[model samples]
Structure formats: C-alpha cells, structure tokens
Target: MSKVILITGTSTGFGKLMAITLANAGHNVIAGMRGVTAKNAEAAKELGALPNIEVAELDITSDNSVNEAISKTLTKYGKIDVLVNNAAVSGFGLLEAYSLDQIRNMFEVNFYGVLRTYNAVLPSMRANKNGLIINITSGASGHTLPFMIPYLASKFGVESITEGLQDELSQFGIENVSIQPGVYPTEMNNGSKSGIHADKPAIIDEYGDTATQQFNALGSALFSKMAEFKMDPQTIADGVLALVNMPKGERPLRYPLDAVAQGTDQEFIDARATIKAKWLAKYSN
Candidate 1:
C-alpha cells in the first residue's frame, strides 16, 4: 500500500535516509526540515526528482513553522497515514554543571519539539480515527551514557511520552511506536563530542594540566566507543520500515534497533529492577 508519510529533521541523519528510502518504496513522503534555503532547495529538488518525495520547511521549535508544514503536507497529500517525529538535538555535560538556559534549549528541541509536532498532526489523526506515530529515540533512553546527561534526560521524557500516548491513542485507533537506535554513523554522533561544554570551569590555580588531560581522555574514549558500535543509517531506516509495516496487533510499541542496543537496554532494566527491589525490601511496610 502506498501510504502518505510525514517526517521531520529531513535535512540529515535517519530522517533524510528514511524519507528517500520510503519514497523509493512508493510511499508519498513529506520531508520537513528547519529552513528551505538554496542549499535545502537543491536537496529537495534532488529528492523530489525521485518517485514521491517533497520537502517543506518546519522548525519544531516554532509554532508557525510546524503549522505551515502540516498545512502544506495536508494540502499536497490529502492526509497523513504515518507521522515520524525525528527532529532532536544532542546535549552533553554533567547534570549539575549545565545552566538553566542550556537545559531549557535542550528540552525545547528534543522534548518539546516532538510534542509540538505530535500536536500539529493529532487533530487530523483523531478525526480519521487511524494513524501511526513513530518517535525516534536513542539507546541512551534506556542506558545512561556519561557526559550526555541532558540528552538522556530528554530521551527519557520521550520514552515516557510515547508509552502513555500508545495507550491513550489506541482508543482512537492510532498506533504509537518508538525506535531506539544504537550508535549510528550520523552527524549526530560526530557532533556530540564537540557540542557539550564542560560543566565546571577549569581551576588552573589548583588541578591544572592533569584535570584538562583527564577531560580530554574521557572525550576521546567516548568517541572511540561510539565508533566501535556505530551502525549505518540505512540499518535504522530498514528497522523503521519493518516496524511500520507490521500488523497492528503484531507491532511492538518499542523497537530496539540492534543487538547491542537490546542487550544494553536489558541490562539497564535489570539494574533498575534490582535497585527498586532492594529499596522496597529495606523500607517495606
């Protein structure tokens, strides 16, 4: 079946790959990005040259952008059968070290961005009484990665939101799904290392050179580990296609993309269970 799909963050990463692949697969793709400058226009032209791909400007942080993109998509496609919330930003640093503005900006993009997009499409979906909402989260949603506290927090919020939406929207015949992809060779992981500033200012008068060296070492290790497990963006796109194609009853609410992510998620769940059990035993009524 050739369904109409709307996707965000199509300027790059999984969004771009999925838009191209889905269009190639004979679906109508409304690819949304922040701005349609000359560069983006060229990219959209290239994509539109394909079977059924179109690009629209959509900044998830802005209500006008989100509304315009939704209106344009509806005007072109009639109705959206699938909505993928893939627009998000990465933030790094110790939790205690980040400023309120920095934290708010992170949530604005990662958390509230998805909410805005979801709200923009819900009215139509509800009226139709059928639709799919796919949220692209991260493996970090289940496991904590050092120095990526803010990013993890945002994704955790996404996980919670998706879970609740799945149950709440089911009554309306809408399906909500979340995909947690492990480290992938995207601009996201490439930009992660440089994007987050250190939480604390350097105390050169006290712990000078050693402290700086340790911080540098930690970042290098993080990047190296990410490279070791990085999967291709196409792998994620394939997983998304599979999840979307599954029958309603058979579809999983959350899909972990790769083996490594599955194992890491299990470990995190087990650790949480153990801690909760211990706490209950220690303070039981």
Candidate 2:
C-alpha cells in the first residue's frame, strides 16, 4: 500500500535516493530541499519524473519554512503518514578552533532543524493519531571521533531528542525511530569541509603547525577509511523502506544501518562493562 511521505534534504545523498526510490514504489513523496533554487528545481524535476514525487522549498533552520512545508504537505496530501527528518549539516575542525557561532550554526541545522520539522509535522500526526518520524543520525552519535566534534555533538542531540520523543509519543500512536547510518560516500563528507574555519584560531603556537598537519592527515585517512566501508545509498534507502513498512508495534526504536558500527558499539559497551566491574570490585573490597 502506498503512503504519503515527506522527506527533507532531497537535493542530494540518502534523502534524494530515498525520495526517488519511494516515489518509484508508488508512494506519494513530497521531496523537500533547501531554498528550492534552480539546482534544486532541476533535481526535483529529475525525481518528480519518476512517479509520485513533489518538490517543495524547506529550510529546516527556519520555523516559517518548516511550517509552510508542513502546511503544503497537509494541503496537498491531507495527512502525513511518514516524516523523515534527514536534513543535516556536517561541522569539522577542533572544537576550540571554530567560533561559537560556527558551533551554534551546526546545531541549528542538525539539531534544531530536526526539531523544527518535527514540531511542524506533529500536530497533524497527533490529530490523526498515526504516523512515523524517522530521524537520520550517525554512528558518531554513539561513538566519538576526532576533529568532527560539532557534527558528533549535533548527532548526539538527535539521539537524545529521538529517544525522548519515542517515550513521550508512544501514547499518541506516533512511532519515532532514529536511524544511524555509518559513513557513506556522499556530498556530506565534502560538505563537512565547508564548515572548517578559514579564520580559525591558532592552536597552541609551539605545536600549531604540527597539530594542523596531523589534523589534515587524520582527516584524509578518515575519509579514505570511510570510502572503504561506505555502504550504497540504496541500501540505506531500503532500510528506510523497512522502517516505514514495519508494523507499528514491531518497529525498532533505533536502527543502526552499518554492520561495522554495530560491532564498534558492542566493543564500546563491553569495554564500559569491564571498567565498571573493575571499579566496583576495587571500591567494594
């Protein structure tokens, strides 16, 4: 059965691929992109030509834009069966190197942006008492990585928000799920570099240049490693399909899309358990 789905960040990456895939599946997809400029218009045209896709302007950072997108979706589709909050920006560099404004901007797009979209869609979903909200988070939400502090922090916020919503909205018949995808080959990796501070503060002067060089080297290596394990966008899209189609009671609260990420998470869990056991044994004795 085809359903009405609204997805953000359809201009590129997983969002765009999912929008196209779902539309081709005969689902009514309202593909939302930032600004809806000529480039987005062209991308929308390509996706819309598929089957049941509609393009709309949505800047998740702006409340007005979010409200308008929701209003349009409701006006056109009458009810939003699924809302995929996939719009996000990646922030890179040492935490101290970037300005507070840069860090705040990262949260605005990644954390608050998801909130704005959620708030806009919640009313209708609540009224109908049936809906699914899938938040696209990352492995960094659970594990830390060097130099991507802001981006990881933003995803952490997402993890918290989605978990809270899952508990709070269960009674309202709204299923909230957080989908964490491991690094994939996408514009996001390139997009992350844009957030690097050109006027970044100098590191501790004695080791500044060395630190910068090490950071650059690490960043390159991370990207190279990401490429090695990068899953196909369509595979993640298929995961989205599974989430959307899952029976209400059977839907997973959190879906980790990367096998390696699951393994890494388990390793961390085991390490934490060992540390806790050692601490308890020492203190209790």
Best candidate (score: lDDT): 2
- Write candidate 1's Cα lDDT for 16-101 as tens digits: 89998888888888888865776567667666677788888888999889988998888777788999999887765556667778
- Give the alpha carbon lDDT tens digit for every residue of 1-285 in model 2: 899999999988899999988887889999999756675777877776777888888889899999998998899779999999998877667766778887888889999999898889898999999999999998668767777878888898998898789879988899988888877777887663245342365643544777778888977776776777666778778889988888888987677777546477646545755796799899999
C-alpha RMSD of each candidate structure in angstroms: 4.0, 4.3
Worst ten in a row by lDDT for model 1 = 196-205
Q: Which stretches of candidate 1 lie over 4 Å from their true place?
A: 192-222, 266-285
Give each model's whole-structure lDDT: 0.79, 0.82
Clashes of each: 0, 0
Compared with the true structure, model 1 gives a TM-score of: 0.84
lDDT of 1 at 174: 91
